[model samples]
Target: MNDQGQGITVVSLLLAGLLLYGGAGWLLDSWLGTRLFTPFGLILGSALSIYVIVKKMGGVKS
Candidate 1:
């Protein structure tokens, strides 16, 4: 795939991660009557997505 395609894929992955995790967090907050999980979930999702992207893009060759 070309660079543009790769860029699009990365963006999509990031957005999906944020939405999926953030939405889960929001649901949890609604269910449990808390207001912290949303941010936490978003952070976790972004971090995990970054990790996945790094691995997929081939980080640090030995």
Candidate 2:
């Protein structure tokens, strides 16, 4: 993929990770009555997204 394609892929993955994990965290917080899950979810999501981005882009050369 080109640079623009890579950028779009990374952005989409990050956004999807954030929404999916963060939403799960929000639901967990609501169910468990805790305040820490949301931030945890966001951090986890970001980390996972970065991991995915690196893994996906690792095989490609410039």
Candidate 3:
């Protein structure tokens, strides 16, 4: 369906944004020898993964 294609595009964009934003921050913190960014990376990755899983499971039925 047309909407399913759109969903894929949107999800891809979200994933890219999450990686560039959160991953960059995590890398910076890691370089500085701070562990705080590790948790942030995990949280960001988990939250985005959950969102995509829910979205794919017809959670958007409206």
- Please name the candidate that would achieve the greatest TM-score relative to the true structure: 2
Q: Considering TM-score, where higher is better, how would the candidates rank from best to worst? A: 2, 1, 3
For residue 13, model 1's alpha carbon misses the true position, in angstroms, by 0.6
lDDT of 1 by residue, 1-62 (tens): 66798698799889988999999999999999999999999999898888888877755554
Instruction: Give candidate 1's root-mean-square deviation (CA, Å).
Output: 2.4
Model 1 scores worst on lDDT over the 10 consecutive residues at: 53-62
**TM-score of model 3 vs. true structure:** 0.49
Candidate 1 residue-wise lDDT at 62: 42
Residue 17's lDDT within candidate 1 is 88
Model 3: ten consecutive residues of lowest lDDT: 53-62
lDDT of 2 at 13: 97
Supply the TM-score for candidate 2: 0.90
